[model samples]
Structures are given as C-alpha cells and as structure tokens.
Target chain A: MPNILVVEDSPTMRQLISFAMKRIPNSHVIEATDGVDALKKMSSEKVDLILADINMPVMDGLKLVSLVRGNPTYKEIPIIIITTEGAEEDRKRALSIGANSYLPKPIQTQELIRLVNSYLTKQ
Target chain B: MEKETGYLNKADEFLQMFKKGEEFTKELLKENEKLRYKIAQLEESMERSGDEARTKLYEDRIKLLEDEINSLMERFKQVEEENKDFASKYIEVEEENNNLANLYVASYQLHSTLDFSEVLRIVLEIVINLIGAEKFAILLMDDKTNELVPVASEGMAVSAAPRVKFGQGTIGIVAKEGASYFSDNLSYMKEFNPTTPIVCIPLKIKEHVIGVISIYSLLTQKSGFTNMDYELFNLLAGHAATAIFSSRLYTQSERKLTTIQSFLDILKEKPRR
Candidate 1:
C-alpha cells in the first residue's frame, strides 16, 4: 500500500480529494491542515508521495519545497504543487525551488491519476 | 515827375506781394505729394515684412508638430504590436492548460473504480509515459503516528530504500510544510539520496497535508525536472488524496457495521425467558 500525503486548507476541498483517492485500491491517504501540521506529521510517519497546495498559512508551499529539498533525508521525495496561481512565474518559482511537478487548481481526477501512476510505476 | 515815380513804386510793391503768394502755394502742393509718396512706400514695406514673418513662423510650428505626431504614431504602433504578441501567448498557454486539465479529468473518470494502490500504479505509469521519468515513489503520511510511510515505488530497490521521518527527509519536509520540493543534484547534499536530480510534492486536501510524492533520476546526465512537472504532479496528488481518504472512510464504516451485526446476531440467538 502506498502512503500518500494530502495537504490543503479547506475542509470541503480535503473531502473532495479524499473521495477521489478512494478509487485507488489499498492506498493510504493522510491529511494535514497546513505546512506546520504537515511537518509535525512527517516526523513520525513514513510517506511515499506528497500532494500540496501553494497558498497555505504557517508555511506556504514554496517555502515547504525549499525546506524539503534542503534536507538530505527527504530530498529524493517527489513533490507536486497544487495551486490556484496559474501564472507562469508562479510555476517557474515552484519548480526552481525543488517541486517535482505543478498543477493548477480545479484538477481533473483522471489527470491526477495519471501523474500519480507515473511516479508509482517508476519506483 | 515825382507823382509818376510814386505811382510806379506802388505798382512794384503790389507785383512783389503777388509773386510771394504764388510761391507759397507751389511749395505747399509739392510738400503734400512728397509726404503721400513716403507714406505709401512705408506701408508697402510693413505689409511685405509682416507676411514673410507670419509665413515663416507658421511653417516652423507646423514642422515641429508634424515631427511630434509622427513619433507618437510610431510609439503607438509598437505598443499595438506588443499587445498583440502578449494576447497570443496568453491564449496559447490557456489552451495548453485546458487540454491538460481535460486529460486529467478523463483519466480520473476512467479509473474511478480502482483502489488506492491501483491508482498509484496507474499514476506512476502515466508519469513515466508522459514525463519519461525513470524512477519515482509515493510517500503517505500516517495521521495517528505522524509519520511518512512509503506506499508505492518503481525502478528502485525496496530493500535499500531509506525511510523518511516526519519533518526529517525531503518527503517529510514537504508533508510537514504542505509544499513542494526539488533538487537538481542530490549528491551535493548529505541528506539527499545518491540520486542526481529529485523532485517532491505534498498531497493536499482541503488545505491539509496528507502525503508526499517523489521522482528521481539515477543518472546525472538527465535534465532536471521542470515547473510543468511539478504542476502535473500536484494535480495528481490532489486527486490521489481525495480517493484514498474516501476509501479509508468507507472501509472503516464497513468494519464498524460488520462488528455491530455480529453483536446483534449474538443477541438474537439468546433464548427468551
């Protein structure tokens, strides 16, 4: 079973995402409210993949990326940034800071599955 | 002789007076004509100078204004061209993004029945096919223990894989912070795995941190990941988290219902007093 982490700020959005992940079999999906909470969760749990939002309080997605990439222990992990900011500059900054992939807001379920599958299969 | 001399003197005086009067009238007429001629000449000169000066000033002003207008027109044309280019590029980007979003939705609907594991497998396959990545992994967070656990992996050794602690490894950091992380050269950092280039993203739900997803390149020769890759991964992460969460809830509910049913059956089996 692949352990997946989902970080977002909205309850409704979180629920929607959790519902979508149910389609996958034997996958464990976890949730966090913000970057600070996510960091707290990371200290104890072993996670395989990360799905994150950019505009979050306590620690924005960009800052989280820099911090993660700076750590040698978790540097190899792939990070996917989900955000409402669709500007090219925002995407560039996310990638430059160490994000594995970027996705704009209002994502489609199939595209999400495709991206996740790519990472799962390669490992 | 005396009387005749006096009479002749008086005549001479009268004659002298008449000549003086004639001379005065002639002088007055000549002065008037001279004055008229001078005034006419002066007026003509003034008119010529005024016309010439006015024409010269008007032409100068017109030339200056024309130059200003031409420069403004050139600037306007340049601005128009720039606006057009910007509009075109914006449309192109919007179209590409729309296509990607559509593809994502279609894939999600196609695999709606698969479980989380299957979804992860599908995700990895799609990433490899679409992004040409050689290696990848998915790390999920445990809410109870607050740990990041590996759920799925490909193109890597499972036995030698290093476990990422919450807030410790790159995956942990992303999970904890609810953000994305990437590195071009893993070898440079002591904490990074021996991989050359790596990228990671946090799966988020309702602004919550759920898990982390990562991809890496074993060979140092491959080009590092780009912003587009991060965007795509983020999209997948969101959907993955949602599906997994719902599945877990459903399983929990099923288990509870089963337990309750067993207890009810025991009660029903009891004999009535």
Candidate 2:
C-alpha cells in the first residue's frame, strides 16, 4: 500500500482529495490540516508522497518544501504544490524548489488520480 | 399275507421321491432371490456414476465462468491504465498553453506604456509577482557617469552604494561586455555575496547594454532560480529596455514641445516691431 500525505488548510479540499485518492487501490490517504500538522504527522509515520497547498496557516507549502528537502531522511519523497490559477508565481517557485511537481486549483479528477498513481508506483 | 407286504414297500418309496422334489424347489427360489439383489446393486452403481458425471460437468462450467470473469477484470484494468496515460498527456498540453499565455502577457505589459516611472513599476511587478524574486535591483546606466545606478530596488539595501562602474563588478561586467549572465553557480560572485544565489541580466538596446537587472539574495522560503527566470531576464533585456528608452524620448519631446509653444505664445503677445 502507498501512503499519501495531503496537507491542506481547507477541510473541503482535503475531503475532496481524500475521496479522490480512495478511488485508487492500495492508496492510503493521510490528512493534515496544514504544514505544521503535516510535519508533526510525518515524524511518526512513513509517507510515500506529499500533496500540499500553498497559502496555508501556521506554515505554508514553501516552508514545508524547504523543510522536507533539507532533511536527508525525507528528501527523496515526492512533493506536489496545489495552488489556484492566479498564483502562477508560486507555482514556478514551487518547481524551482524541491517540489517534484504541482497541481492547479479546481483540481481535475483525472489529473489528480494520474499524479497519485504515478508517484505511488514502485520504482 | 405275501401280497400285503409288497404294497407297503411301494407306498414308502413314493413318499421319499416327493420329499426330494420339495428340496429342489426351495434351492431354486434362494438362487433367484440372490440374483435380484445383485441386479439392484448394479442399478445403484450406474446411477451414482451418472451423478458423478453431472457434478464434473457443473464444475467445468464454473471454471469457465471464473476464467471469463478474470479476463474481463484484466481488460478493465488495462483500459484504466490507458485512460491514465491519456490524462497525463492532456496535462502536458495544458502546461504548454500556460507557457504561451505567460509569454503573451509579458510581451503585452512590456509594450503597453511609454512613461519611465510606469515602465520601472511594471518591471518591478513582473520580477516580484511573475518571476517570484524577493530581492533584486534595477540599475539604469547614467549617460554622464558611464556607470550603472539603481532606479528601483526591492528587498535590497536601500542605503548601499548604488553605483557600478563599467567592468568593475559582477553587474558591471554585464554592462561592459554587453552580454547576459545566468547561472545558479555563484562562485564568481564570491567577491560580492558568496552564500546567496543570484541571477543578473543586462538590459540592452540595439546591441548596447543600457541597464542591468540583478538578483542579490533569495529568501530562505523562496526557491532558487528557475529557467523561467532566465527567460524573463532575457525578456527584460529587450522589451524593458525599449520601454524605458521610448519613455525617455517621450519625456524629452514633451519638454521641447513645451519650450517651443511658450516661445510662440510670447511672440504672438508682443506687438510687431
């Protein structure tokens, strides 16, 4: 089973992503309210992939990317930035950083499922 | 007396013959009962064999159905995988469209105005909002001093020395050489800022480097330079320079027009000598 960590401040977005990931077999979705919560959760459990949103409270996705990439243990894990359309600047920044990829706002079902399955695939 | 004895012997022989016939009838009846039991057993064995054959047929049918279901499931999975591949391709196309849109916007904004201050403001907006640079400076070449001077800066030291003589500093080299510099490797800039990564590009017009836009430091939260930033830097080199140059000419032309109009008005007010 592939364990996915979803870090989003909005409960609605979290639920949407979780529901979407559930459709993919062998994918276990872990929900985190924000980056801070995500870091705390990641300490105890192993996460195969991370899907995070920018502009979150307490800690933002940029901070999370920096932190995750800085740590040797979790540096190799794939990170995706989920942002709205207007924040194209942040999207570029996300890629320039250590994020593996990104997802646009109003997340597409096919796109999201595709990204999840791709990263969770064994190497 | 002799005739009466012979009659008694004949009656005894007749009774013995009748007993032998009765025994033979009993033995024939027992043998017939045994044959009937054997026939019933044979019929039962045949019926059991028929049931076994029917059970085997039912099992074969079940195996066939299971194989069909397995094949259907396999086909379904293959179709799902194919759909996922298509989705990925669609996303790639969307990204290409996004890039084109960004380019169009960059071009439009660069050509939209001819005011020096507005041009500077627009360039600042593009760098900060579009390129995601938190710390940078825009230095226009001073015609008289032959040096680069900062006109607009963000997240940079406002009080820092704002002059770069030709062939003097990292940005100065760009101005002197009339070429662009874009590399994540910052070993050359060690004389200025060793630790922080930076991106610098010279603004040029008609093969002449007019000004330089350079990033000095990056916020820890901010990501490092991307190829997009290099592309933007390349854009600024041309479009931004043209806007600034045109805005300067427009200002000068307005000033000349004002001077000529005032002189004409004075001539009209004065009486003809």
The per-model lDDT (C-alpha) reads 0.69, 0.76
Interface RMSD of each: 13.9, 11.7
**Which candidate number would show the highest TM-score if scored against the true structure?**
2
For model 1, what is the alpha-carbon lDDT of residue A74?
74
Model 1, residue A29: C-alpha shift (Å)? 34
**All candidates: TM-score:** 0.41, 0.50
The lDDT leader among the candidates is 2
Q: For residues B1-273, could you state the per-residue lDDT of candidate 1 as single tens digits?
A: 999999999989988888888898788889988988999999999999999999999999999999999999999999999999999987677656644544464356424644555566655644543344556676677877777677777667543345577887666777778877776565543343622227777778878877776776432223444455555666666776776666656667788899999999889888652
- Please identify model 2 stretches exceeding 4 Å from their true place: A1-123, B1-60, B83-104, B142-145, B157-161, B183-197, B271-273
Local accuracy of candidate 1 as per-residue lDDT tens digits, A1-123: 877778877543455455556556777788987887777777788777778888788888788788878988778777888776566888899999999898775554556766876876676
